[model samples]
Target: MGFLAGLALLLLGLHLIGEGLSSVKGKRYLLARAFSRPGSLLLSGLLLGLLSGSGTGLSLLALGLLEGGIFSLGQAALLSLAATAGAGAWVGVVALAQREVAEVLLALGLPLFLFRGSRSGGLVLLGLGLLFLGFLEMGQGAKAFAPLLSLLNPGPWALYLVGIVLAFFLGTANGVAALALALMPFLGQGGSMALTLPLIHIRRGGQRGS
Candidate 1:
């Protein structure tokens, strides 16, 4: 139930983001004007991910920017890389947050998800909340399987390989990273870091928009 609800909110946020970008089709050029330098573009991508709190949403915006003839394939790749890093930043922060603090944040944001009167901004908040909530539930579920996880004592290489696959199917590197962080005590630094690589490596790429 949490997974479905989280996915729904994620998709909704993506939709709202797409529509918001389309509505401001005129302003993308403004973005283009700001990102003339490679370093600047990379920085912008990181900032975008951090500000939006959604790498997927930033990817969609990057696609729009590409369509506007603002970003080349190489530039888009850099942007995507930066976006992933940005996402990592969020995951790190969340990993460091107290459990109670996270719950408070989720509770505070629930209304935005329930309330339909909000615009794109609210949708983004709601989506983030749902994503966090989903991750929370997943973490709880994983706790239930702790015994099974403990039985496996794979080498670092094997763990990384499996983590990549698990993260891929899970479809959110942040969630994977958060889980890995939670397991750091049991898995050690090497094993926990292994889980984070999948998030860094699984970024998506597509053709420059038509």
Candidate 2:
């Protein structure tokens, strides 16, 4: 139930962010110019992933940018790759600072949302807050299965299969990574690596197809 609730919050947050950002004037042109260079594009992708904490979220955003004429297909592909790497890089940070970030975003967003002119910005911040809160909830929910998971001596293939299914449902390698981090107390180092590796491959493949 907690996991499901977290998923709902995650989806809602992403949707709000998309809707809010889409309404921002001149953003498309600014983004297009910002991503003109490969270096800048990679950095931007990484920064986005770090902020959003979801490769799938980044992919969705890239797709939106592509449709908006702010990004070419090739650039979108590159951004997805860079963003996924960035999301992986953010797993530890998310584990440590999820609640704090969520609280900060909520504190800022709520007041800003009251103002008409800053509504879009407020929505974006609220979305970010929800995203982190969802992550925190999901982590807590996964703890319920820790004892059962610890009893299982699953092999690499089993772990990989589990990861694929999780990525499919969560729609992001980052989510899988975050979950794996949460389960590390049960899964241990080797199990976590086995679970995440295939999910990364799967996410990259999905990104390419998108």
Least well predicted 10-residue stretch by lDDT in candidate 2: 17-26
lDDT by residue (tens digit), candidate 1, 1-210: 443454444344434434433434457777777877899988977866664455675666677777767878777677777875776587655544444654564565566547655444444544455445554554445554456568977678887887888766765565566667656666779888886665555554322331
Can you list the residue pairs that collide in candidate 1?
A: none
Q: Which digits, one per residue and each the tens of the lDDT, describe model 2 over residues 45-139? A: 88766755667766776778888878899998888888877766766666775688899998998888889999888888898788778777876
Question: What's the lDDT for residue 148 in model 2?
Answer: 72
For every candidate, C-alpha RMSD to the true structure in Å: 5.6, 3.9
In terms of TM-score, how similar is model 2 to the real structure?
0.71
The Cα local distance difference test for each model comes to 0.60, 0.76
As a TM-score, model 1 comes out at 0.60
Question: Which clashing pairs does model 2 show?
Answer: none
